[model samples]
Target: MVYRLLKYVVLGPLLRLLWPTKVTGTENIPAEGGAIIASNHLAVADSFFMPVYVPRRVTFPAKQEYFTTPGLKGRLQKWFFTASGQFPIDRSGASAAQAALDTGVRLLAEGRLLGIYPEGTRSPDGRLYKGKTGVARIALEAQVPVIPVAMIGTDRVNPIGSKMWWPRRLEIRFGEPLDFSRYAGLAGDRFVERSIADEIMYALMELSGQEYVDVYAAKAKEELGEAVPLHGRAGEVGAARAGTAPSRVPESRAG
Candidate 1:
């Protein structure tokens, strides 16, 4: 298949020779069966490094625009994404969230490793943002464990607004699987979903050692502009601009 050819014959060798990625906790990944790899969204390269390092073929639901761009370069982009095992998803309208959940659930039910960015979008300032509850819903629905992953230094390699990649040493850390079986059959409860999502984000924070932001990454990007203040200070400023009272976010409800 194209995925194997690209990984073993082309992209794999080039990425390893150029970026020099270091990965830990490969044993934590399930050798078989279904699971979700929930990770923080730091940069576009997060997607690239995650799949390359994992032994299993990981599939991510990329935005449809990545596949629908016009011209020759667009076609190549589409081909590369497809070869890399990414599929397109329509991330528009009110049903967009549900659509993504459905896609992930279907993949999990088919016994594949699904990579999901719980933040919904890339972090504007490299700080880990609050996760959306869709990841929790998928895990609960599929009855699979959520494995937290952290991509370190990917933002520096392929920074936002930069078309060129600066090859640098990067890392992929896989944390132990998190089981939410205690909350089984409770996916419909919004409070339970939020708690589960927040728990996954907390694990990502510990693994990545990034400052946690309680607001969603997209909302922070809109209110705080493209450049969010680094560290944990952006939350207060963003909350003020968005007219929400800033409070200490609990670990179990950070999302």
Candidate 2:
């Protein structure tokens, strides 16, 4: 498949060479079952790196704009993501969220890995933001485990304002899976969902060692008046405006 071949041939070799990575708790990833890998978004490189290191093909819901471009560039962008096992999610409207969740649930039902960033977007600072309830809803509804993953040092390689790369060492740590079966019957309750989301964020906080903030990505994006574009130049601009640059993120070895 494209995911395997690309990882082994292109991205994997480059990652191993340019910025040697150290991974922990990779075994925490379920070998053969549906699970949600919830991670904190720190940088643009976060998206590419997470998929590269995971053993199974983990699909993330990307904005539909990545798929619907105006020309050949858009076509290739769409192809790349589709081939990489990522599906498009319209990050707009109430209907879009429902549709996105439906796609994720279906993938889980088929025993596939569904990777999501509950914060919804990369944190301007390296702090773990309050997660949206969508991730919790997905887990509880699908009866799946949510694996907390914390990524460090990606912001250095391709931080907010850079077109080029830097040779920063990257580390990805996968935390133990959190089972939500205990809250299955309470899936539809917003209060319960938000509580579960908070719990997941706490796990990420412990894993990544970043300060926690009680704000969702969408709200943060709005408060900053940032207009996110599809990809390429527009994406770079948005990233820069949003302060996605590398920072002295505080992290320590897990005890």
Off by over 4 Å in 2: 224-255
How would you encode candidate 2's per-residue C-alpha lDDT over 104-190 as one tens digit per residue?
989999999999999888875455667788998899789999999999988678765567888888899999998777676777878
Query: Candidate 1 local accuracy as lDDT?
Result: 0.84
lDDT of each prediction vs. the true structure? Answer: 0.84, 0.78
lDDT of 2: 0.78
In terms of lDDT, which candidate is strongest?
1
Instruction: Looking at model 1, report the run of 10 residues with the lowest lDDT sum.
Output: 240-249
For candidate 2, the per-residue lDDT at 118 reads 91
* Model 1 TM-score on a 0 to 1 scale: 0.89
